[model samples]
Target: MKTWSSIILAGGMSRRMGSSKALLEINVQTMVELLVEVLTPFSRKIIIVSNEKDYEYISSLFQQALHVQIVTDDPLYQGEGPLAGIYTGMKELQDSWYFVCACDMVKLHPNYLVGLQERLHTEIVTKRQQYDAFIPYSEGRVQPLAGLYSQQKETIKKLLDQNKHRITEWLTHMNYYRIEPSEWQGWTPISDVFFNMNKPEDYLQICRERGK
Candidate 1:
């Protein structure tokens, strides 16, 4: 398997949910905890990006966990959104590739991640250099957060320096490998795979679906 690290962005305001969504419980596990569990099987290094206050709380929860790093946004780019989190993680780990996702993601399909890793390995071996990322594209939307990124420290740093913080717009300018919905059919519905608990209603919906 190709070597890689992961970043979990947990610094959102959570205004819609009216509370820290990263700490929200689903299936008896906090959202952040569940995400760590899901990614632990795939990568040895996992970074959780949050604010200083949240970082303390999150770090306490995993004091004994191996290879988990809880980090606050880089001081220079504080509050710059997920793009900053990605940039910070890339700078910290300096890994060849990274898998980034949000804390609000309710389900992460391991099988699909394995498939993505395989595809990334092929791209590396074939010297496919046109793209710097491998992201999911479905229903006319690109899921930037739940994708794999090649070393993009400089690209991300340039965007942060220019005060352009929109992740989707940044993605548009980069050459990326798009994993179409059809490619994810057998593992799970694409919608479910990318399901995000962005609001109270969304959280309730997940609870209901899970028979909670």
Candidate 2:
């Protein structure tokens, strides 16, 4: 019911995967393409933040199929990490709420994301100033990328200005609502939804799952 924008952080070095994970495929579609498809219905705008070199390659794949805006990290914050990607996206888009995701996530659950948006909107209507972010917590770790951020431009900029680019560190200073894994039990298994491909083994695992 709440309209928001989405930012896919595909700028990772992927050193562990030894290749661009965004380009990795599931059923012949790149990871970025699949993520864009999953997010298109929920987002008013979709932004893909990637490195300059990979921008062209990624664009070539989706420029025609989807109406997405692909951008490189701000020159000022190049190579700063996912926090910089979030800052760049929030600064570029006018949306008050943003759903940030990592490109490595192969099985994104739309229901889970929609549920987060619902929770965020409910809080906005009831306790507006209580939270700036709605993130998920699973296996005792907060999933920053798979979260929604609100009015984050200035706050994120402050962190970037201070040279503090860690997302977890930045979260400590904001009023954030954490959605526990228990909250998503009915929609899908937490492990399947949050599984991110960081290495060859992880990718292979997803491939094997798909074959089942």
Candidate 3:
């Protein structure tokens, strides 16, 4: 098993949701909590990168789980976007690769992540291989929310120190991997594994899909 910590990036403003999407409910459980449940099977430790008062509510729910920790970005880094959240999470972990994820990706399959963990053995992988990050692309777009990153304190700090805020811009500076849809054949049961819950309408679609 790959010894890694999973970091859920819940610090985004969620302008589209008009509220903290991380706190959204699906079958009475908050999205973040549900993500934690699925990640427990794969990670040694879990951290939440969040903002706003809602974290208190979320924290109360996970207080018993010793492996879960929550960290909010400093004022300077806060509101800077997902890159800042990713940087904050990587710095928090001492000696493990980070499976960085976003709270919005509600349909993320655990097997999909397991597949990526198995891919960790490739020669293309490295702790300091100059490949600063890894991401998966699907349907013609790079899915930044689902990624695996090394716990490089310097790289994380440099990211926070830089002017680039958008993840795509920063991705251009790093060497990374793009797992095509064709690569996941017998692993995950779900296709479009990166399908995220961006809007309420999408949630309704998931509800419909699940119903069928």
Give the per-residue lDDT of model 1 (tens digit) for 106-202: 8777777887877787888898575688998766888898899888889889988999999986886788988888886564544578888988999
| Residue range 1-212, candidate 3, lDDT tens digits | 64578989898777776778888777777889889988888788898988866668878888899999988875678788888887777777665577888897778888887877776655345543544556777788878778787666566557668776777767766677776677753558876777767777877786677562
Per-residue C-alpha lDDT of model 2 across residues 79-169, encoded as one tens digit per residue = 9999999988988877888899999989898877777767876887887567788888877799888888886788878888899999988
**Clashing residue pairs, backbone N/CA/C < 3 A, model 1:** none
Candidate 3 TM-score versus the reference: 0.88
Query: lDDT of each structure?
Result: 0.86, 0.85, 0.76
Question: Which sections of candidate 1 miss by over 4 Å?
Answer: 128-130, 187-191
> RMSD to native for every prediction?
1.6, 1.8, 2.7
User: Which 10 consecutive positions of candidate 3 have the poorest summed lDDT?
Assistant: 123-132
Candidate No. with top lDDT: 1
| lDDT value for model 3 | 0.76
TM-score of 2: 0.93
Worst window of 10 by summed lDDT in candidate 2 = 183-192
For model 2, the superposed segments whose C-alpha errors exceed 4 Å read none
